[model samples]
Target: MTLSSSAERPSRCADAGKLEVSFEFFPPKSPESEVALWTSISRLLPLCPSFVSVTYGAGGTTRERTHQTVARLVRETDVPPAAHLTCVSATREEIDDVARAYWAEGVRHIVALRGDPPAGIGTHYEPHPGGYAYAADLVAGLKKVADFEISVAAYPEGHPENGSVDTDIEVLKRKVDAGATRAITQFFFDNDIYERYVERVRRAGINVPVVPGIAPVHSFKAIAGFAEKAGASVPSWLAQRFEGLENDAATRQLVAAAVAAEQVLDLVDRGVTDFHFYTMNRADLVYAACHMLGLRPKTDEAA
Candidate 1:
């Protein structure tokens, strides 16, 4: 559950297919946060992720900001940008129009999702009338608009609303059938959970790369809160690692780094070559984790 900070960092992954990484960031809410987001983007850019995704706010709240950020990514950066498109509060035409705009702006990848309702109602989710009813439906609609590479979400631990993790896998199968090219799992701490989920995925005949999602703990308490709503479990041991470190930022950071590095390294040891990082719009811990994974800056011929 914990790794010493002094453990050796790998220089590279030698296994077949090697290692591939991608990052996720939410659109900024303010000018200061926007600056922080770009700062993070700069820090991770040199690691050369396959693509970086910008998240859409629930009910499409950050729709314009997501579009603007993605357009900038297309124009300003060398990396491919994947804009999140959700079937939240928009009509089919509206969503399609946004897709077309992204295509015109040189954005070729999309993260399609069936986002929570805009109104933030309780657990009962009813697809908005006249909108795509589910993520599978959304994926199909995105395909019709353009032949963009699509990445859909998978829940290794069942989604809070889903009664069974197996049911979530079935939905993932339909998404792949509808043209999703990849799947990024919900962030998970337990490798066993992810390994078993992948096993089930293969048994269901879904062969797409189901990348494990890694979330570096910026704040354990906050993350624990999110896990509760996300239907993901936070082990008691994790809390023990953070206990009494609330006021100690430096020590807490080291502990957080240790925990996340251990998680990813274990996955690497398990032969998982694909990874998706939920950056939470910050980069320090993520950068460190990638470094341990043998990802180096562009100037580093050592990578």
Candidate 2:
């Protein structure tokens, strides 16, 4: 039985077991994008994600936008919000003040990262003279500011700059030791790479949840470009699936839903329960994928 990319998802089973999911969104750059972000949130909210996270840009305008979106989540939504924080150009005092302000706003979770250099990815990363230096240092510093639940970045394929997976695991161990509560991976298309990475992580005695990040292919061209820079390999079959559909947006949406659902369902089969979706601030495909996984809009029994 061949499954069409857009075929209806398999029916949910009574004994399908339990699954949990979280979503990640970036700060919108414009009023139109902001509207799109909230619309996405409104759609996913009914599915009751474990917690939603907003991505932080290294500095300047994006940083402030991240704060505003996160603050609004705290004030307007019932779901817990996790704000991304990175150690890059800022001093320790500046980073600490941001953490403190989040605490003041009742935001309790952070995704701490040793961000790319101020020049962006592919450039040499230099720690600021007065900054926390790396992700581990930032994690420790945030812990000092408050007992915030922190998540750190992980890589299925070793990080582009790291020479080996062993070194990557070492960096993760340091972050975990410094009080990271969990690790969310850089998105990858291959589940086997993720499984092997998790095996290596557990072997190193790191026990916190290493959530798999799922990136739906909103645009093959865009995702392919980003994945290339991030060191994740885009499989040949995946490329073939999207090939020649460049001019067809409707077909692309169906293919995207099918691809994401297939990945998540396979993950559930592997006994993994928690998933982190890189929503890219759109809801339709992600929503359909969640529905395929048997998740439904949560109802308030009191209503």
Candidate 3:
């Protein structure tokens, strides 16, 4: 199926109403952060995302915390939680144990990844001798444990470690072959990059949904640092938007909302429906963007 550059908007079903959306949050590092995260979750829950995900830290550093957070969500909230499992620091047995525990706790979705190294994103990744070799391997292993709904990462620009676009697509295909049900891309600034990448993936014969991951820009410096390590390009135009708003929190928030809303709306206009928001454990900006996209609470009648 050849996708035209102009065919970027997601197809909508009149009977199904607006498009479905999801969110991603990381495990909190402190009590104050925990409070902040729950507050954010509460604010966005009314929008009724398809599911919410919590990120696992590098080298399994946040394994326990991630499990706790995901389990709590299953126990306390109406939202279905997707727990991220990575093949970085643990052996196959250990990784499987985490997946089993999540299943026991009623978590049916898993976001599998070849996580970052202990030293962080820029450092080279070296797989443990007895661990799952890559995310594809981990996905296969998880399938043996349970009939889990799996999602893997996709790179729009390209992965830092991959040789070329073909290699990247091949890796994605392998993940799907290993039982991944969907792919969520790394956060990107330009929608054109995402459109082209998705075209290539479909051309490669991978038929799963490749959901776009949208990161709401909260702090310019913080996001820039992340882009540097994650290999996501920060367009000059984006830099100009935040150029002089360092100390201007009020103005920066306004600009951030506008910039992110423009990106998602462009994606919507292009025919892309499903969005996975990297909420950064904050609600105001992401919530505002979702509202602009026509998302609303699921009232009792609708439910």
Candidate 4:
């Protein structure tokens, strides 16, 4: 699919009700990046995503920036902010303080995660000495701090450390048992992988909504690197879709939008309603995909 528009793809079902979407953003490290982050947020907010989440960096490195971004969204925009809290290197008390602070700021949703190790991807994860040990523990701790509508990470491709798909579902079950209300999966290119994971989660009796994570391919090379580290398999077909577009930014964006539209439309046909987009702090591809899904910019009155 070289430089095609989503209009070439099948139209969304007439009866497919408006798809619910949430976008993920990482905290910016500098003033210029912060401006870019908000610019992306401003563009996507008008689409009225179900919520927007700010990610915590490995070992809580971006904790403050993530908090500031979420707080600003709560105060300055109509988009619901779901702060990402991780149990990586902080004590239980420290983590609790952050959760309490978010509640104080009128932020109610949280995407709780067992963040990557301090040494970064592929390193062994060691829980903080006195902190919530895992995401399940973090969900329970956040509930103790406040009745947060907690969202936990679900690995459709078993977590690199966990080493098995069955075990991944078991871990997710523990999280749901520990008060997580939803599970947003790590991004996957194969819809069958996601479908099978959801089926297994249901068979295991973990009943919370498992929202599919949809990553619109902003940059094929960038996404491939992320997928490798994050344990998501990038199918050959997916790779072939972006072949030869490395130096072509404009064509890349168009192909990205079309590929993402096809993915979401396939999911919608499969009865999936909610989608969580890993926006990578850029708006165009994700915005275009959502527009293709029949989601429109929120009018002033709606806001």
Candidate 5:
């Protein structure tokens, strides 16, 4: 699928109205980061996302912290919390216990993942012995414990470990068959990649929503590093746009906003109605993008 030139792009969706946007946040490490994260949450809560998700770190390093954050969201906020569960370094009983605990705490949404290897992204992933083999297995286990709404990860380019696109789609199908309600994609910068990926998934008879995950590039260097490991392509044009702007923080942020807004508007023009943002615990850039898409804070009257 070829992309249109920026000037040749169609008009924005006037009648599209506000999209159903959700955010994914990670568990913060320090007290300061914790405060910052909640502050970001408070800011985005008014946007009334369908739900907010907390990420489980590699090897389940942040399991307790992820639980703490999800539990707090359930206890304190009006938003629904989706806890990320992974099948790395955790036994079946332990993983099931976590799911049961989330159920007891009123969290009904789970993002099941075949987590990165304990050694990290580039390393080979050997599923823990006696543990769930992949996200599909974990999703199946969660369904038995409770009627939970499960979301699993989907890769547009392809999973890092998968042999091909057909294999990736088959893995996704397996997850859905195991009862996942939806599949959220890993972040990709190019809109065409996402559009074509969605088309392919639909053609494969997977009817569930494959929500595009949009990551607002906060730091060019940091995001580039992540993009390398996640199989998300970083276009040379994007690199050129950010070239030599490292010394200019304010200008870099403004450029980031414009780039992300264009990416989303392009998507909306292509008929996307749902979005999942990787907020990285920051609010302003995403807030601006959502505003451009016509999303607004819910007022008391509306509530």
Candidate 6:
């Protein structure tokens, strides 16, 4: 039977077969957006994700807001929060202080990266005169501050700045050696690309969970624009899927859920279970996708 709307679908309870998920959110820029961010958090928290992360802005632009948001998550939420740290514009002393503060605040996990240059994407990234030069250096430094569980960025398709896949894997190996426990990938639509990258990573003897990053296509045009700048490929097939639907918000949501569900299920069938969603601070599409994956709000029995 055809469903009248997305809400018509019935909710299921958590399943016996386990599939762990995490979500990523960016710190809000305004009071109103802060309200929206928490609403999204409350909506998705019930899924009992492994952990949620708040993103740091380019060049530490949102350092204070990021700290505030992450501190609040530690203080108020049952789910663990991972703070993102970047080495783009800060000195080692400042970065170390941030790490120490997080540890003091009971924040133990961090997504460390060599953040984009302050000038913006595509511009050259210059390390601060006294800061860590790369993510591996930052990871090592964090380890010195505390035994924090660190996660670094990975790319299925090699990073834009890297000259080759081998170079990218070498960089990743350095981070893992430096104390990274996990690597969350840049989102990609093709499972083959991810699988290949994982194979390469494994062959290099860097053993860690490189979790797939999944972005539910909220706005195809917007995501396409981002993918373009971020050096991610937007498949021609994906474009066809969203063709001519830019004006249709309601139908677009439905299509977005379907596409994301299909992507995750296909990955599940291939023996992948853990996933990290770049939630973009919107919950409907992600919640719907999790529902289809047989995840549910924790009930007394499930909890």
My TM-score estimates for the predictions, one after another, are 0.93, 0.93, 0.93, 0.93, 0.94, 0.93
Predicted candidate 3 versus true structure: per-residue lDDT over 37-94, tens digit per residue: 9999999988999999999999999999999999999999888999999999899999
Q: In candidate 5, what are the lDDT values of residues 162-237, reduced to their tens digit?
A: 6366788989999999999999999999888888888889899999999999999899999999998887889999
lDDT tens digits, residue span 31-88, model 2: 9999999999999988889899998875433789999999999999999999999988
Q: How accurate locally is residue 286 in candidate 5, as Cα lDDT from 0 to 100? A: 92
C-alpha RMSD in Å of predicted model 4 compared with the true structure: 3.8
Local error of candidate 6 at residue 264 (angstroms): 0.3
**RMSD to native, candidate 3:** 4.5
Write down the worst ten-residue block by lDDT for model 1. 7-16
Total backbone collisions for each predicted model: 0, 0, 7, 0, 0, 0
Clashing pairs in 3: 8-270, 8-271, 9-270, 9-271, 9-272, 10-271, 10-272
When 1 and 5 are scored with TM-score, the better candidate is: 5
Model 6 ranges off by over 4 Å: 1-17, 120-122, 300-302
Compose the digit string of candidate 4's lDDT tens values, residues 23-49: 999999999999999999989988878
> Judged by TM-score, which candidate is best?
5
Q: List the candidate 5 regions with Cα displacement exceeding 4 Å.
A: 1-18, 119-122
TM-score quality measure for candidate 6:
0.93
lDDT of 1 by residue, 175-259 (tens): 9999999999998898899999999999999999999999999999899988997889998889999999999999999999999
Error of 4 at 229 (Å): 0.6
Write down the lDDT that model 3 would get: 0.90
